[model samples]
Target: MKKLINDVEKVVLDSLTGVQAAHPELRVDLENRIVFRGGTPRQGKVGVISGGGSGHEPLHGGYVGTGMLDAAIAGEVFTSPTPDQILEATRGVDAGAGVLHIVKNYTGDVMNFEMAAELAAVETGVRVEAVIVDDDVAVQDSLYTAGRRGVGLTVLLEKIVGAAAEEGLDLDAVTALAKEVNARGRSMGMALTSCTVPAAGQPTFELGEDEMELGIGIHGEPGRKRVPLASAAAVAKDLVEPILADLDFTSGPAIVMVNGMGGTPQLELYILYSEVAKLLKDAGVTVARNLVGNYITSLEMAGASVTILRADEEMLRLWDAPVNTPGLRWGA
Candidate 1:
């Protein structure tokens, strides 16, 4: 229950205020809870927008900048943003080119974003397309998802697709690239501890001292199963095996991310990454580029997730393109 906040109800708003103050290069519409790049929307450039519940920092919000998301809408912690709010963001960021909504495959998120797209079309004649990410190989059905939950691959999708958009790719081309990225990626997560939502003031779930939950979702929902705690290498095998089984990453270069689920320290994340690298090499998957650390998190939950994206030459080149954002920045 110990949280660094003034009021439980104001957590999302208060944190967004801080984000606005910290990054002057971005524009924060506090009233609408939208974050956009601090410049004119490039003419003819496809607009990329993604949104979801709050608490997963540096996600939809931290990614708003050059060569990434043009705008991000925020909702209450673990809650979907309203359709009106998403519509505002779409209108604000839409240039002559259409806007692409990079929606995760959660039910509420999908529904809300769809509603927003429809509203934008009817009200302003803004063209909108959506690319739903459901790369989590955890469970077929969950509390919030129909097939698989969108997990770490959302981060990779935003990066690669953003680069394509920045390169002036049209909306149709960007949408196609986004779907290709989603199809080529797979993710699996584990949790050593549960997270405490600020409003709830209690842990969402519990884990025994010698236990771990595999195939965990980002919202602290129950994972596929609980298992006795084991060595880092064993845990790495469990995560990597499912992702490899779900996709044939051996066909080309791969982009690998060992993401920390908030409370896990960098020391342990590196240890996990080492094991993941070893396992991928043994499976004949060539790692062309890798990202390690807490890119996508589940509040203060202690654990990590593995995301693997099979990359062709075009995907790899786009990934190397310059990106400048609060969460991810390089070559810019």
Candidate 2:
């Protein structure tokens, strides 16, 4: 594949070296494949940690900072981090209060994080709780997960729950907030093109020029179905309808995100966002806060995903809280 890297095996390590150099605010543990916020384990704050494969940039790693994740472990591309690596991250960030692991609803991620929590509890005596995000309404099952994949809501969860952790909520309270967020959010994604994994040196999947994959997962796996490509408005409808139908978003203010899947340009994403916003407005859903950009991505995949969270006053307040991270930063 035509990717910029020294070698296939060194991609994660080399990219992490660049992360360490680019952002001094983050402490990078290259050997262990963990990224930590500088000056971690903030006395009594609940530490937040999330991890996954390496191709999805500005995800677990880009989110390590003052108001989001305190630490993130990196796996190989689209692979789950080992239990030992996760245990290291949990132990490193435990501040006596406890640590919260925000795991996406992928089989590998869920199992690995669960094992890590057990190991950390036994070996380090550090309290650990986990919040599994299964916000994608794309499918009831997928190759990588038993239920819906976590998808875009994981981003919203990290920001909102991270604020709670930063505000010194105990581990239990933070975990509760995370669960609440997951219950209130839903997501759907579509893909126009496939992504190429550097190690494999080929696109993960193939799509005809006139075709699109609806209900796509982030790993470049096959989506729910393939359909003829359509207008942005039609695509937006396909995304929003399932979300609104699955959850009653009109009853409250909503936080909406129109996320690009790695390769889609901001201009295209904004156009798609405009369409999504219009649909939400017509459906009587108030958009309290909106994010339009690439947050969670599949490696150079061309597509977009929409995430909607039914926000109560507390969730809205948390959304407005100050956050400082490489991926998302505002009011910090």
Candidate 3:
């Protein structure tokens, strides 16, 4: 209710305008809401395309730059882009090398992206492959619902896979790298409170002043449970334990990211990271590379998400590649 904006319906349009204007190296397709890599799609190199909702700023669009995504499609706030939009972007970015769609594991997102791929196969010879990230350990792979929500690990996937694409790896190679990251990564999120979607115009869920929701989804889906607020160390344990249990991060070195859920501050993120470091050390996992910030988030949801990636030599090499984007920059 307190959000600063003209209209809830125009949030995506308004935000994209500013992003395109600020970054001259990027080209925006307003009608389609796809962000291209500021030039014609290069031939003989694999095209990387990613997208989801709008509130996760500097995500799909922000990462569309050199050594990153070739194009990014934007959906309505917390909603999936239409299949037609995704198909257009897929066709638009095709340069004979094929295109990869990096999609999160949300219901609408998965369904829409799948439909788009089907359309692409029927209409064009542009080969499309997707690597679905279900790294969030929050949701159990149950028989009823979508298994898990892709969360913070998605940010890492984009960087490493993008680097592989920049290295001129074939579509299969890049997708393999993307899958490797997804398989090795595990994430868990905790929410201090729920966020209100502009369209809904109300809080998605409620948490008491002294309670927090654990295992929350980015769009404010109810988490596994809400518990009384606990100490930073206790909360960090809540976030990290599920991830550690979900993956074998202890057997080798790992890359760790402590991500804020939009409303949390850097200071709190670091405080949580401190406890995460201690816990990982105790678990016999080595933190090789670490990022502590808001890489992925729910809108103004006060909390954090922890992601751990088991690293290998090849992944480490790609992780070091230069990347220029609004959210992350490295090696340059």
lDDT by residue for model 2 (48-114), tens: 9999888888898999997889999999999999999999999999889999999998999999999
Runs of candidate 2 exceeding 4 Å displacement: none
Residue pairs with backbone atoms closer than 3 Å in model 3 (clashes): none
Give the per-residue lDDT of model 1 (tens digit) for 1-332.
98899999999999999999999999999999999998847778889999999988889899999999999999999999999999999998899799999999999999999999999999999999999999999899999989899989999999999999999999999999999999999999999999999999999998999999999999999898999999999999999999999997656899999999999999999999999999998999999999999999999999999999998999999999999999999999
**In angstroms, what RMSD does candidate 2 have relative to the true structure?**
0.8
Better of 1 and 3 by TM-score: 1
Relative to the true structure, candidate 1 reaches a TM of 0.99
Per-candidate Cα lDDT values, in order, are: 0.95, 0.93, 0.87
Worst 10 residues of 1 by lDDT: 38-47
Residue 310 of model 3, lDDT score:
95
Ranking the candidates on lDDT from highest down gives: 1, 2, 3
Any runs in candidate 1 off by more than 4 Å, and if so which? none
Q: Candidate 3: minimum summed lDDT over ten consecutive residues — where?
A: 136-145
Candidate 1 residue-wise lDDT at 193: 97
Question: lDDT winner among the candidates?
Answer: 1
